[model samples]
Structures are given as structure tokens and as C-alpha cells.
Target: MTTIERELHIEASPEIVYEVLTSPEHLVKWWPDEAKVSLAPGEPGTIAFLPDYPSVPLTVDEAIPVSRFAFTWAEDLQVTFTLTPSGTGTLVRFVESGHADAAGHAENVRGWDHFLPRLVEYVPTTVAA
Candidate 1:
């Protein structure tokens, strides 16, 4: 299976970064257009891009406060976000696995390339307010 990995440094604490990554309200600001998901592990949910793409089903696989958040989506794909404290900020490691083909992997890579930057730009200003 193909996997996508990315690393980003955000000028915020792990707590803030984790909240943005996991919270449905914060999610809509960056990635999905809408998110209906419980934070509890094994809980089911859906994230929609809207007007273009259909909603994708997902399940929370893990949620460790301020450190790790992971979910399984689209039947077989799993995405994990790992957070670590850095100098006055947080280092985020993102991994998405279980891609069946290079085309799918490349498509998601582009998606993340667009969205992750929004996360970095949105966090410090919005969350700190």
C-alpha cells in the first residue's frame, strides 16, 4: 500500500494543534467543508467537501490528547497525526496510509498540499483569539 507522509512546524503548542486537528468546528476551517465526528475511538462519522465531492465515511481509530490523533476512512485508508513539542511551538507529523495505487496517492498528496497550509495559517491567529 502507498503511504503519504508530511511534516510541518506550527507556531503553537501541541494542545492547540491537536484541537485544530481533531475538532469538527476547527476542521471545517482548514480541510473539510463539514465534519460530523465524535472524538471517541471507534466512533463513526463523515467529512464532506461539498458541491464537488461526496462525503467520506470515517472512524476514529485513536485520540490521545495533545499528542496523537488517527482515523480510518474510505474503507481502508488510515490517517495519523502525531504532535511533538518544539521550541515555543509544535512539530506535526502527518501520515496517511493504505492507498491502493499511485494515482490515488498522488491525488491525496495534492489535497493535503493545499489543506495543510491552511491549517498552518489558520491556527495561531484563530485559536489564540
Candidate 2:
């Protein structure tokens, strides 16, 4: 399985980071074109892009509050977000695994790089407010 992984340092606490990561409102701000997510494991969420597009599904695989959040996204790929308390901030190790091909792998790698910085930038502002 091809895996895409990246680490981001967000200037916020782990609890804050996890909240932004799992919350539906915050997720829409940073990921997908739109999302409706529930953070509990075994519960499913829906994602949609354009009006003509069908909603895609996502399901939480594991969630351990401020420590780990993982889910199955886009049918096959598994995304795991691990939060570590670093200094006064958080180190988020983001991973998506089980790509079916190299192109899909590369795209998702680019995808995470594109989206995670949004999380880094968005977290502190919201958490501080």
C-alpha cells in the first residue's frame, strides 16, 4: 500500500488540534469542498463537492481524544492523524495509506500538503479566541 505522510507543527494544544480536526465546521474550513463529520469511531460522515457530484462517505476508525484520530476516507484510503504535545504547541503527524496506484498516492500527498497548512494556520486563531 502506498502511504502519504506529513508532519505539521500547529501552535496550539493537542486538545485544540483534535477539536479542529474532528469538528464538522472546522473540517469544512480546511478540508474537502464541504463536509459533515461526527468524530465518534464507527460513525460515518458525508463529503460533497459540486452540486452535480454525489456525496462521498467517510467513517471514523479510531479516536482517542487528543492523542489520535483516524478514519476511512474516499472509500479505500485510511487517514490517521496523531497529535503529540510539542513544547507548548502540537505536532500533528498526518498519514493516509492504502492508495491503489502511484498517481493516487502522489495526488493525496499533494492533497495533504495543500490542506494541512490550512489547519496549522487556522488552529491557533480559533483556539486562542
Candidate 3:
């Protein structure tokens, strides 16, 4: 299995960051054009229109508070988010494994690199509200 990982330093606590990461409202602002997600623990969320590509049916594999989240796209592709604490901020990392080929891996990594940072941008604003 090939693994591509990205790390982000966000100016927010893990708890606050986790909420933004898991909540649909926050995700829509950064990720999908629109999001349908449930806030209750263990519920599922979707980040629609996963940019620069055709539509694919993706399923949420897991949503754990302040730690990890995962989903699977077509062809057994999986994307996982792992968050860790770094001093006063959170260290967010994304790992896209289970991709069948190099093209799939590059596309996902690029898409995530584009969208995930936007999520970090919203963290401060969401937490303050």
C-alpha cells in the first residue's frame, strides 16, 4: 500500500479543531460545495464534489472526535485524517491509502492539499463564534 501524508499546523485547540473537521456546516465552508453531515458522535459526513474529477460515491468509514476520520471512495480508495496536538495548536495529517494506481494517489493528494488548508483557515473563525 502506498501512503501520502500531509501535516498542517492550525491555530486552534484539538477539541475546537475536531468540531470543525467533523461538522458539515464547517466542512461546506471549506471542502465540498455543499455538505450533508450529522454532528452526533459516530455519524457520517460527506465532502461532495471532490474537485477536479468526476462524481464518485464515497462512504464515511469513521468519525472519531479530536483524533481520526476516514472515508472510502470508488475502487477501494481510502482517505484518513489523523489529528495530533502540537503545543497550543493541532497537527492535522491526511493519509490516502488503498489507491490502485499512481494517478489516483496524485489526484487525491492534490485535491486534499487544495481543500484541507482551507479547513484550517476556517478553524479560527469557527472557534471564535
Candidate 4:
């Protein structure tokens, strides 16, 4: 059971960050061109970069507004996102479990490093207004 964790700080409130992270419409703004996530929490979501990786369909397991969201792509691969309010900003914590091997972990880490920066850019400046 390998695990990878990452943290990102955005200049937006937790509520706004959570919405951008969980909603498909907003996800498209930050997610890579190769990535596509359909649906949102409490419904269904899928993470994939077709032709390069397997399409891992998922169902949202739990969601608590601006606090936490968890989903299972497979019985073993579970992903969770946690948002914490931090001094006028939001702390985003991402955890992924059950990478079968080093390659899988590396791929995921690289993918996030590529997209997470975009998320920071997408954080609405109007949040404080």
C-alpha cells in the first residue's frame, strides 16, 4: 500500500478552492489538457489521460463541502482531498493510496506536479471581496 501526499496553498478561501477542485466545470480550467474529470462529488467522477493510462472510473465516496472529499477509483486505489482554511488562504492536501509500483507512483506525482500549478493560478482573486 504505497501512498503519496501533496500540499498546495492557494490564495482563495476553502469554499472556493473546494468548489474548483470538485466541480468538473472548474476542473477543466486547471486540469491538464490530457486530463478529463466528469461529474462531481456525490455523483461520479473519472480521472484519466487516455492512450497513456487506464481510465479509472470512480464514485464519490464522501464529501464534506469545504473540508474533505474521498473517492475510490478501484478497490485499492483511494484518493482523498482535504481543504483547510489558512490565514486568508486555503491549504489543499491530496492523498493517494495503493499505487501498485514505483512507476505508478512516479506517474501520478509527475501528473500532479504538472496540473497543481494550474490550480493555484485558477484560484479566484475575487474570493476576498
Candidate of highest TM-score: 1
lDDT of each prediction vs. the true structure? 0.92, 0.87, 0.75, 0.75
| lDDT string, candidate 3, 51-123, tens digits | 6433545567777888987777554777787889999899988787887778867887788889888988889
Q: Residues 1-129, candidate 2, lDDT per residue (tens digit)?
A: 788878899999999999998888788778777887777778888887667545988999998999999999789999999999999899999888989999988887887888888889899998768
**Model 1 ranges off by over 4 Å:** none
Q: Measured by TM-score, how close is model 2 to the native structure?
A: 0.92
Candidate 4 stretches greater than 4 Å from native: 32-43, 50-54, 125-129
CA shift of 4, model 2, Å: 0.6
Model 2 lDDT, full chain set: 0.87
Rate residue 56 of model 1 by lDDT: 90
Q: Per-candidate TM vs. native?
A: 0.96, 0.92, 0.79, 0.79
Clashing pairs counted in every model: 0, 0, 0, 0
lDDT of 4 by residue, 1-129 (tens): 588888988988888988886676676677733334443555655665545645656777777889997877744678888999998798889898889989878887887788788888887643543
Among these predicted structures, which one has the highest lDDT? 1
Q: Write the per-residue lDDT of candidate 1 for residues 1-129, one digit (tens) a residue.
A: 888899999999999999999989999999999899898999899999888767899899999999999999887899999999999889999999999999999999999999999999998986558
Of candidate 3, the 10-residue stretch with the lowest lDDT total is: 39-48
Model 3: residue 96 alpha-carbon error in angstroms: 1.1
Ten-residue stretch with the least lDDT total in model 2: 45-54
Task: Show model 2 residue runs off by greater than 4 Å.
Answer: 51-54
Q: Rank the candidates by TM-score, best first.
A: 1, 2, 4, 3
